[model samples]
Each structure stands twice: as structure tokens, then as C-alpha cells.
Target: MTQTQNTTHGGPDALGVPAWDFSSNANACGPCPTALAAVQQADASLYPDPTYAALREAIAAFHAVDAGRIVLAGSASEFIGRVSAWTAREGGRRAWWPAQAYGDYAQAAQAWRLERTDDPAQADLAWLCEPASPLGGAEQQAHQVVGSALQVVLDRAYEPLRLRGVCSLDPVAQNHVWQLWTPNKALGLTGVRGAYAIAPEHALTEARALEQLAPSWPLGAHAVAMLDAWLSSAAQDWLTHSLPTLREWKRELCAMLEDLGWTVTPSDANFFCATPPHRLNAMALRSHGVKLRDATSLGLPGQFRLSAQAPEAQVALRRALIAQKERVA
Candidate 1:
């Protein structure tokens, strides 16, 4: 009896071409039985109340800020969407967009008819990213934040720098800025849709009133369970301890790609950007079963944003990309 194996990962890997999808900002969370059970047990309960209460404490404590500063939401995207609406209602001023930032920032500004301006002091809002999501390098990063003119809406998706660092919550910008954080991106909870906003405590005054006029809110009992489990010292230790292995894997990714002749932007964050040799564009990379964000969208000099996935996955990607190099030559 040829028993069929239950394959859990549903991707092009099933095909001969290895799949390297580095489009997301999330760790490949371990689906431990205990954590999975927390989600399963929530099958018959309402989550918003319990989840929010627990997460409120957990997240705020993590950031070392007051819980009131947080606006737990479906995702960082939601926080941005609502905040843009608030900016509009308060009279959308000229929008400050990074020379290169998350695509949604442009969409958010347009939805509210915000004018674009690179000058920060004269700007009404600044929508930006940190570790500069699409592209990353020490010098490029320093240039991005070297001397800001106005309020900073730091997209600290990579802030904790892998669990051990002091979960820096944009301290410099905390005085008069709005930042986005998503546990989904940070804690391998991508599938959970857990995100929170860290604004100055006073921004809460303006935000709380606005939140009332906002739509209904709820935290899935399941999501809460995951958050609860994640808050425990045990879970924290697990994540905090995994940094070395994670860092090693990331370094391996950069070294391997470099050895294969790819120009990877230096990044300590979970991902990095790469400029393929002139002969190859993003589609060519995708053809090898890796779906990278096209750098062309950022109007940058590259055409790919690669990530470091599981070690096995990285090995597969390295081989595929190397094969592509040979094919082009």
C-alpha cells in the first residue's frame, strides 16, 4: 500500500524548481504543537476581549512604553490606513514620502489626496520604513535618517533586530511620531495578523477619540492565544535564544549569494535587497521559483529583494539562482 505523505507546505517546491519567496517580512515560525493547540482551542471562543487585554500588557511591556500608546490592529497596514484617515480629517497636509518606502504609504497618501514633498519640516506627515524594507545597507540607512526635518513615522518592522536588542520603539521619534509594528512580521505570526502601533502617549488623546468613530474592533480568540503563548518567558526565551542561529543563517545567505556573484545589500534585518547582474531581471529570478519584490518599483538600481529563509530553503534558493547564472552565461 503506497501510503501518500501529507505534505504541509503548499508551494512550487513540489515542482522541480525550488521556490524562494522573500516578499514577506516574517520569520518562518515554528508550528510547535503547543502553540498550534492554543489556536485550535480557540475554535469556540470570542477572542477580542481576552486577546486585547493580554496583548495590551504584553506588547506595551515589550516596547517599554505605556499600553495606552498601542492601537492593536489587524496588521500594520490597518494602522496606517486609519492613521491616514485621521490625517485627512485633520486636514491632510503635504505628505512626506521617503525617496523609497513601503508601497502602501503612497496608496494611503493618495486615498486622502495628500501632496508629496520630500522636505520634512514643511510636510504634514512622513510615511517611511526602517531597515528600509525593500533595500538595506548601513550607509543607505544612515542617509535615510541622518537628519530628519519633521516627525518620523519609522516603519520599525525590523526593530528588535532579532529578539535580543532592546525592542527599540523609535525612541527618537516617540516624541511626536507614529510608528508601526507587527508581531506577525516580528514573531513569525504572519498568519496571525497581529500588529500594534506605538505613538507618543499624547497621540493617544487624539487617537482615542478618533478610534471611537472608527469601525468595530476585535482580537480573535485564536490570535490572542498565540499572543499569550508568545508572551510567556518560555516563548520569549525561545525567540531570544534563536537569534544566533537566525543570524548565522542570514550571514550564510549573504555569503552564498555573494559567492554566486549576486550583489546583496548588507542587512542585519530579516531580509536584504540585491541587484542582479544586468543580464538578469526579477522575472528571471522568479522563473527559478523565487518570487522577489522587484526593486524597479522603488525606482532603485536593483530588481530583487531576497530574504533568508529556513536553512534548507536557502540552500535550495542558492542552487536555483546559481543555475540561473549559468543559464544566462
Candidate 2:
């Protein structure tokens, strides 16, 4: 797909929202009550601290890192753009990312005129999203690219929602790369649009550069509130409690799709990609208020990425798929 078309994200748009959305990978058991309450109670009347000192401190404490190493972002997309810009500013000529991964990485690279490289070592910058989107599988190349001269940024957006498997990188290895986290996904509050990157330990220079590139007041009050709640023990406990429910739902959904002859790919996160035995008319399903992310944009043609959702939503999806099949028949 062309860059313009490939960059399309799965969320409410001109077609309106889906009744059973399995497009975006937000936690099925969320918006967590604690985080939701915090967002609702956010004082939007006043601007957040420009320095984001308190917010940074809170996030830093949660990760047990120095506040100075925390680089704030308006959102994951914003950070992608800012980092791409930083790469460009530093005379980076090329960028590398997974062949099938988030489209924004490519979009940002395109905007900055950075040539795409398939080999990590050949690129000035590289992007890695663990339990990556579309397939939701562990990144096979993660360990290989480490210790290279490549400026690697690990997108840990799905880490909180990971249902199984251990991360490929140990603490020492993780400390060598930029670790980006978007709490909104874990909190099931994507609308809040706040993210932060824990700069590699001892990489204060690069961290300072990223901070300088970001816009002032990168996070608004609501985003700050959601993120603040994200670091709380109550919120963590809520997320912990939701995982078992998600695991069970995932198992049921996978079984249902497999029984229907869909090729469900194994995944460690809350989402997975599958290709049906027959071609599926996605728009037809969307008409019935059921939506699945067309993975063609994420470089997986003839497949769709589905997020684990409540059983009722799964039932709605199954009904819609059957209806579509009937219509085609």
C-alpha cells in the first residue's frame, strides 16, 4: 500500500464507531476504573506544568529511574515524529523498522526523507515494537540489533497488555536502547494521547536532544491524569486482575476462529492476526457494526488483526461474520 493509505489507523472515523471493535488493541478489560476516574476528575481548566516535573517524577518513580532520564511525548505518534526529526537533524540518512510493523514509523521516516533500510546495522535509526502490532509476536530481530551503532528505540506500548512470554531483552540490554511506553493503551484510554520514553541509562545526551525537540507542555491535564493513575498501585492491581479474564477470552476467541477455519497466528499479547478460510469482505462486516483491522496496512495482506474482547463482543463478531458469509453465499 502507498504511504498515505498504509498510515490509516483503526479507530472511530467517518464511518462512525464500531459496536464490537476488534481493530485497535486497547486492553479489553479496560478503561480501568481507577484510571477512568482519574481522567474524569482531571482539572482541564488549568495548564499542566510546562516542565512536567511532578508528572516526570511520578513516572520515574514507577520505573525506578532518575527523573532526568524521562522524556515526555504528547503521544506515541508525536514521539515517533519528534524522534524521526531528531534523527534527521542529526544527519541520519536512513531508518530501519520491522517489515510488518506500525505504519507511523514509515510515515515519520517518509516525512523526514529518510531512506528505509532493511538491515538494522546499515540504518542510522531503528524502530522495534515488542509483541508487535498486526502479528503481536515477539520481535525476532530485537537481540541482533543491540550493541550496534544503530540508534534503537523499543516501542513497549503492548508490554502492559502482554498476556504471556518474557521479554527478549534483559535489564542490561534494555538499558542500551530507548524504551517508549504509551500507558493509554494499557489503561484502555487511547484518547488521552500521552506517552513517555525512558532514555537509555547514561545516555543523557540523547535524552536531552529528544527533550529539546519536543513541543512545550507535551501532555495536557487529562493525559497527565491518566498517566498519573497508570503509575498507581490500584491501577496496576486492576490491570493485573484483568489479565486472566483477557487470557480466557483470548483462548475462546482463538478457538472460535480456528473452528471457523481461520488461520490464527500465535501471539503473546492481547491481539493476534488471522486469515479466514475464505476471503472476508471487511466493509460488509463493518456495516454490521463489527470491525477488524485490515492487516494489509501493516504489511500482512489477506489477514486481519483482532483484539481480545469480552465474550459478548466476540459473539457479536461471530454473528456478523456468519451473516457476511451468508450474504456472499
Candidate 3:
């Protein structure tokens, strides 16, 4: 293992929850009622089936994949670390990920001492994320990267919340790489930590290795309930219906940033990156109970990732921005 520092994240911080926060990529319209109710009603008194037989079957049916191909994880981050460790343990020496991606990818690589390489062809493992984080743009080189790497994992954490554009990878290409899905963010239930990965076709050996590496009952009852709810027609319908509202909110967010003379980057997801007209006083904003995700940690300095929020939250953010500007002036 390698020495590492704590990674920065966007949710509630040491100051506690911000009054208006645009730091995390969670669905602003979420904690979907259906999913929430399922979690609330889950039987916490009992441990879920050790094998998660029924839950795995349900998720597999939803994706139209074999039950044996489903790999349950405590969360997406947990899977990242496990897979990276698997790569290193299998005599894999190098890894690669998107230019801008979740920090955990790199952190996992470091922990496994996998040499970081910019060229996917030279790597034993490669990671991809569509509507890539911090930038929220399509991964243009996905095909090349997926084709080159010996083992690949595509993070689809934001797919359900995608407001525009389609997945860059077609079904055929997708089958060549692992598809990691974290429905908690989309269900608006980030507190419910659960995720699943679809093993690439004929990759049973590797899939079993991952399953063997996992501790028993990786998902708790609440997580199992939440994920089950996510596959329901009611929850799926709710998600589809929420998109238009999110699109409108995103429009308002972009317009507000543009009006403030901030450069907003176009994105297909609910979140996008923006650069303030002046230097951002993040601490001052936090003091005012407002927070934005600083993109510096994600290799995109001078930009902040802002998720589309409701009108009231947007208004609060605008006022905070104006106040911070005046304070700096």
C-alpha cells in the first residue's frame, strides 16, 4: 500500500450541511419517494441473504444479464479499490483513467502501486466515466481506451441522471468492458450505499476473482431495498419524469452563471463546471452556508462543479456569490 491523503468531496463538510450546496452530483430532485420508502421499510433486524441470490437475480433481470455476472459491492468506491487491488494482485503493473475522473480511481491505483500511464494501450487496467465528472462532458476517446486496455471498467454513476446525449459506448462495446453502476445517486438516495458491476462477457474467471475478494453480504438490508426499488417500474417512471425538471433547472443554472460572467462548460449530466469571473473565495462562501465543488482536486483547477439545484437554492447561491464578490472587492 502507498501513503495517501484524504480526498476532497462535495457533500456536507466540517461546517455541516450548507444552506445552498452545489458540491455533490447527487440528483437534486431525489431521494425518490418510492426508493426512500423501500429503504425505510427494509428489515434491518435480519442480515440479507449471504449470497444475495434473489437480489442478484432481480438486478440481472433488469440488465438482461446472467445472474452469475453480477458483482455486488458495498459502493462504487469500494469496487474501484477492489478491482484495482485485483489488477495488482494478478501481476498487473499499470493503470489508466480519464483525464478528469473520480479521485478514488487514482487513489486506488496508488494504493496498489500500479504505475499511472497516460496511454491506455500500455496499461493493464483502464477506467472510463461517461459525462465525465468535474467536466461533465462525453468521453471522446472511450473506444480507443477500451480497445487498448487489457481490463477496463466503465463507471456509469451519472447515466440515470443524464439530461442530454446518449452513452458513447454502444451495447456491443459495453460488453467488452465492465459496467459499474451506482444507482444510489440516481435514486436520490446517496445515503444508501450499494452498487453492482456487470462482468464483461466470458470474463467469468475475473468476475469470480472479484466475488472471492469481496466480504460476505457486501450490501446491507437498506442497500438491498434501495437497489430493488431502483429497478421498479414506479421508480424508473419517476426518474424519467424528473428529467425535464432537471433540464429546466440546469438551464437556469447555466443562465445564472453566464449572467454573472462565469464561463460554464456544457455537459450532458445534471452537473457542469464553471469558472467564476473573479477568484472564488470558497471559505467565505462556506461561512455564508453555501458551497461549491472545487474542481482543482479533479485536475481541473480554476473551475467548480455545480449540480443543477432548485430555484430557491439557485437564488441563494447567486446572492452568496454577489456577497462574496463584494467582500473580496
Candidate 4:
């Protein structure tokens, strides 16, 4: 939505395949070889010690925070779950708000015995999908939550805009415990299953309690290295270039969907949510080999999520949807 055109990543340039909206995180700019090399050089003998220490420092430095405030996690979900669990036990109630966004938040509330309410005033914690998970509400609602520069677990899974200005937190301070960045949707890093959490001291302390209770959640040697490489200078530069390309691709996909006369949400990030124009059922789409998600598992409905990361996947989705329109017509 920010950039106007998508000239760089058209057909085969960004992906070897011919699709644009795939589930794999191919839309991301990070996770290239520039980062993979770091994985190889990682001192495996020291195991979690060196990797965790190095990761803590890198994350803290990247987010501009004191090293002591940083907490590490193998995955962002682990960090969030720990926090939610702690809140339930300590706060004696679920920090749940009656809002419709990411389902994980509600699940956390339910797990911790939090109640959902329509009134924002009654809410103590808000689990926002920062740039949002393709539903497109986080931007407007964020200011209210981060009243005086609020804290966030920014999931820059597909940062359309460089986090500098867009993030609600002290972008320079790295105050929030940002969740994991994987290649599944963008760089094909899903198989590797590596993720990181960047958090302030208190949040880290709370989340770390879960780790002490369950040490198995720590990241493996290579996965942590993969994240480290992306944080490296050369990799960052690559991201600078790759992000816009993804932006362009996303824009193009939305336009094409609109042109087809199907009611599609205008998406700024890599994906959009839509029910077929005729109010088509998503279950049928899955049966046709299109295989769209119902958003219910992730907490959305009549809407499907697409990965704008891979050009081939998007193109494939476009074709599939276009064909579906004809069949329904």
C-alpha cells in the first residue's frame, strides 16, 4: 500500500516458481545466505551459551537497549505464552479484551483464565498484531494501547516498512520482546524452525520463568545462527532492498484481485482477507486444490490468508481465485 509499483519482483525474478501468494514465508527479505553463513561459523562447542549471549547482545544492540534488559526465546509464541501464563498466575485474572484480531491472544486469555470485554477501559493488556496479521486494524488501535509510547511484541514477520518509524514502541530502545522472524512466509526459513524474541528486562524475566520450567524450548545451534546472520550488516542491506520488492508484489496482487470483481480487502502487507464475491464458502476452495485458510484457526472468518512473500504463490492464488469466480458464475 505504501509503494505504488511492483516492477522488480514480477514473475521469475523473486521466486523460481510462478505463484505469488504461498503460505511459505518467501515474502520476507531476511534469511538469505548472508545470514546462513553465520549459522555455519557459530561455535557449536559452547552450545547455547555463546549463541544466547551473542543473540542477546545483537538483539539488544539492534533494538538499541541495554544488554541486561534482553531476554531470549526459541520462538515468539513461547515468549508470549510464558508471559500469558505468568499474568494468569500473578494477576489472578486473564488480561483478555473482547477484541477480534489474532486468536492466539484469546487462547492465551483462555489458558490464563482471562475474560474478554468490549470496553477497552477494562483491559489491562492488549495483544496486538502490530502491523497486524493481515486484518488491518492494529495501526489505528495501537496508539490507544501504547498511551505513552506503549510496549509491543512487534512481529516484523514481513516488515513492509522498515521498523524505524512505523513501530509504536521506542523503536530505538528495543523495549518490547519482538517475536520470531522465520523464512516460511518470506525466505523459505520455515523448515529451519528458528525464531527469536527481543524483550526488555522485566518482560524477559517473566518469559524466562517458562524457560526455567521448560528448558527444551531453547533454540538449536544452527537456528540461532540463522537469525544472527540476518542481523549482520550485509544481510540488513539485503533486507533494505528485498522489503520494497515484496511491497510491490503485494500491491500488484491486491489490484489484480480487485480487477476480478471479487470483494478483497486492500492490504498493505503481504496478504489480504476476503470471502468470494458470491459469499462462496472457503471449504469448497480448499477442495479445489486452492487450499485457503478459513482464518478461524488463527481467528478470522470467511476470509483466507495468503503469503505475499512468494511471487509464484500469489500468481497461483490469483489464477485459482479467478478460475473459482468463473466456476461459481
Q: Worst 10-residue stretch by lDDT in candidate 3?
A: 1-10
TM per prediction:
0.80, 0.96, 0.97, 0.75
> Can you tell me which runs of candidate 4 are displaced by over 4 Å?
1-21, 24-31, 37-46, 148-165, 168-187, 200-217, 281-289, 297-299, 309-315
Against the reference, the lDDT scores of all candidates come to 0.61, 0.89, 0.90, 0.53
lDDT over C-alpha atoms for residue 109 of model 1: 81
Give model 4's clash tally: 29
Write the candidate numbers in order of decreasing lDDT.
3, 2, 1, 4
Cα lDDT of model 4 by residue, 113-134, tens digit: 7676544445555555545664
RMSD, candidate 2, Å? 2.1
lDDT computed for candidate 2: 0.89
Tens digits of lDDT, candidate 1, 1-329: 11011111212233333355665556644443445667677764443663366678777887788777777666667767677777777776777766766767788888888778766666666765656656553224333432453445666677644422332334553555666775445566556765667776567786574455445654566666776666666666666665666677778878887777778776657677776655554455555566555555665644566656777778667676777767777
Which whole-number lDDT from 0 to 100 does residue 214 have in model 2? Answer: 82
Which candidate comes out best when scored by lDDT?
Answer: 3
Q: What tens digits encode model 3's per-residue C-alpha lDDT throughout 1-329?
A: 11011115788766688888788889889879999999999999999999999999999999999888899999999999999999999999999988889999999999999999999999999999987897887888899998899999999999999998899999999998999999998888888899999999889889999999999889999999999999999999999999999999999999999999999989999999999998887777777777888888888888888999999999989999998778778
When 1 and 3 are scored with lDDT, the better candidate is: 3
